[model samples]
Target: MNQQAEEILKFYERQGKPAGQEEILGALQELQQVLGCIPKEVQEETAKRLGVKPSFLSAFIKKYPGFKEVSAVHEIHVCTGPSCGSKDALKILRALEQESAQKERKEGISVKIVKGRCTRRCAKGPNIKVNGELCHHMTPEQAADLIRRL
Candidate 1:
């Protein structure tokens, strides 16, 4: 085990078995502080040390909203499948990126864009979901407008 993993394991053992989400988050934050981003291997080791399933750790990480808030990163999920992409999804993404860049300068919001496949909304082709809200038939200009409004 690496030094970070060892430290995490020692911390977990000291805290006893079945640690809560807050404790897990605290450990993850500590690990990140010590070693930057949490590596998958370290996550697995941390899960093992805490006597929790790897999936449990992963789910916790996914559900933890603290990272984005603390890191000043805003996540935008854009669908880029045959349907959405064909409908100018790239244009929408570019527009959103530009808008985000402007917002970052004025409002200080750091936006991170993620391209998603399908999103199971092909029927709504040209669809984009901002933080999970499905916005269908969105043009590039509309997408830029939407991000600014958000």
Candidate 2:
């Protein structure tokens, strides 16, 4: 385990119960600042130490924007549900993922791409949410361009 994971385990052990969402969020924020993204192993260890299932931690990471790992500037989320899929959502998603990976390799910082179910903008079809802003009717190329600009 990494030093951060060790520290988290020790802290939780001292506390005598599972860490709450706020505590986990705070730890995750610190971890992201120190280590970029939360490593899968660290997340698992954190879940174990807190006595919560890994799925719970995963769910928390998905639900809370603060827990997301991204550069200080922005984060990206794409809708991949049935409605969005009709608009070549998978292609858009792949483009964004590739863009994020390229940025990470070049800049040594991470960008997040979260896939979510309907943002209730089914009318919008393929929609994307960037830094909490909703974008409608995006093509794969457009999504890639948007990430480049960000």
Q: Lowest summed-lDDT stretch of 10 residues in model 1? A: 65-74
Clashing residue pairs, backbone N/CA/C < 3 A, model 2:
none
lDDT of each: 0.73, 0.75
Tell me each candidate's TM-score: 0.50, 0.51
Clashing pairs in 1: none
lDDT of 2 by residue, 1-150 (tens): 457656756776566557777777776666666666665566776788777788888888778765553344467888988899888999999999988676654433466788975788999879999889999999999998887777
RMSD from true fold, candidate 2: 10.2
Backbone collision tally, model 2: 0
Give lDDT for model 1: 0.73
Per-residue lDDT of 68-118 in model 1, one digit per residue for the tens?
212246677888888888889999889998998876644435677888656
Each model's Cα RMSD: 11.8, 10.2
lDDT score, candidate 1, position 67: 37
